[model samples]
Target: MFNIDLFPQALKSDENGQTRSCLLQQTTMGESVTEQELWFAYPMNLPMPEDDDCDSYLLATLLPAMQLRAAIRVHGSVSHELLANLTELQYVWSKWLPERYFLIDIQVDRIRDQDLQVESAIAAFSGGVDAQFTAYRHATGRAGYATRDIKAGVFVHGFDIPLDDTEGFNSAVEIATQVLSDINVDLLPVKTNVRALWSIDWEEYHAAAIASVLCGLKRYAGIGLIGSGDSYDVLLTPWGSHPITDPLLSCGNFRIIHDGAGFRRSEKLIILSSWSIGIRNLRVCWAGNKHDKNCGHCEKCVRTRLNLLLAGVDNPACFDTPIDSSLFRFMVLKSDAVRIDWSLIRQEIIETGRGLEWLPYIEKVLKRKSSPKLSGLFPFGSKRRMWVKKMLMRNK
Candidate 1:
């Protein structure tokens, strides 16, 4: 168990740009390396918020990174193998290993102890719908596929999620605790004072950056990179980009399995709506007002509301907020709006019509299947099962 209690409450930056969160007692491990120190500082793509919501866990989550400073007097073989692939090993350990250690304790049917194991699963569990659904899907199974070899765990990083809002992380943690109730696992929390660094607007591929260090340092199978996928796939902004779209942007080492493509944002909401989720507990606004609830007027809130409405799901107990129809209007007016060719996409969805409209486009973008193009300029991805999938999606 990686104990985070010993981590310091504050840290200072050096002239060379290395951030040390613990001021009083400098880390006794990995002191000299540049990348190691950065990981120890804060394993987040964005700057952390300096506020009440920030706590020791953020500082502690940087422990693997903290090991770079120096070895504390703790006695054990520190198999830094975990450093190479944070998410994958995390999955390995949290999900597979425990089941290996104690089989009778769990409700096992398909998974076997001899099949596989992970060091741990990388997780910054946010209590929102997408995160919840992703975790739930991982736990339940994927398309009738039992996760006999898979595991889930949370690796706390200190960055405040709600654009500097303190309670943003707390709500996420609280909800995550409730959601991960069945899966017995450890919360490897880290405390790193990294609020200032996350403030920078242009962060492209922090997941890859974080996962690489975890993979390189650890001898785990790979890292598990989790993302809703839709946020980046749809939104093009000045500061951020989607992990799936730009895997090459960061240092690639660990195998990142982003569950973004498992389902659409709308589809997730539709499925989640059917299940007994504490819908009132979800928060979508990035504005950092937990008490204010989901501002349905905001772009994020409106998107969720629209998804639920389209799916014909009941609205949960909502705090007072209005959905702005104009936002959807403006969003849809785009040249590449999702329904810009509703007719085109719609025609492809018919029983006789193959889902060629967006399926091909999605396949090419997701690198799910390969297409023949003119030159290197045109990307031809590997086509896994072109006809069968098309038949299924089109109801053919």
Candidate 2:
């Protein structure tokens, strides 16, 4: 068993005082490190300032915190070695951290149950098709009691930022707000930077945050929600053995995480369109250059553009650069699609079986593109996965 003392100081540093992302795991020398641990640490009461604004807590604290939990759990066995050196660890964290936060988010409800006068319910506000559908349901009161009464949010802290100056998230927030407003559910946006400690796993990451929410609810029951939509169906972790584990279940991240059962990307665009989400207010680029316009060449920009095109909505401000046709081909083959395929580009992982992690997602989207059997289809796409998978298997 290998354990990294993430809290301990590193042995050396580069020109900058910045501690490399690697944690030193002091085991009896010569023991091959197996299991990995990593988590992001933030100051306590980080979300207190915006307790009333659920969106702030969810975006700033919950989303980032939960993603750190997912990273420790999902990629533990696969990237355990990524934690070997400080500079190496930082490099891996640079990519892995953002992937973890891809669609992480949360929602809250303070309601009166038969047994208790007041209880707190927490759900993820995944910016995907499934989450969009759930938000719609909460709006019209399809099931029981009209409208979801949620008020908080979360994210993998700085995970929202891009590795390089690539793009922005204006559109994402605009879509999110439009969804919340329709359902009368207040969306809280929180930013999290919990992946700083890469030695701890997802369980502990959520334990701290979930624990914080539980504390926030005080006497009320703490609820962690898993929601619906098409993106949920496409993701392997959304349904199976995700890294989040019990922490995802403590209040339960499983309950709300549905598999492609609700909304599609097209419908979401239509809904947002109805709300008049202008191109400038929406952001989907994640290149790290906040001021720079979207790098249409990146996988993310292309995907967003394709989704919008399929939806029949036109707005150029969201992404200024016209995506190169070659860039689209590269993205189709996993160029810069994060969370879904970003892991494939990792220098080390690319040499392995999962050539580009997004191959599978691309495969899913391809099957749905321009298909006669498809219903309510707009457009989100992918491919080149079989060849990559075959190559990855051959190396072994």
The most accurate candidate by lDDT is 1
Per-prediction TM-score to the true structure, in the order listed: 0.46, 0.44
Q: In model 2, where do residues sit more than 4 Å from their true spots? A: 3-147, 162-191, 199-221, 226-248, 252-260, 278-280, 291-294, 321-332, 335-396
lDDT of 2 by residue, 223-277 (tens): 4444432243344332222323322323211122222233445545655554443
lDDT of 1 at 228: 50
Off by over 4 Å in 1: 1-120, 143-168, 182-195, 198-203, 209-222, 231-254, 291-293, 318-396
Model 1 lDDT per residue over 1-396, tens place = 112222233333554332333322333235422221223433233233221111122222332322232222211111122222333333332343242211111111121112122343443344456655665565556426523223444434443242233465555655555546644432333333333232221132234333332332222333454555454434432212244222322112223455545565656766666455535555555432342256454435544564554445445555354443343432321123333223322332343243233233322222322233222232111133233334543541
Worst 10 residues of 1 by lDDT: 103-112
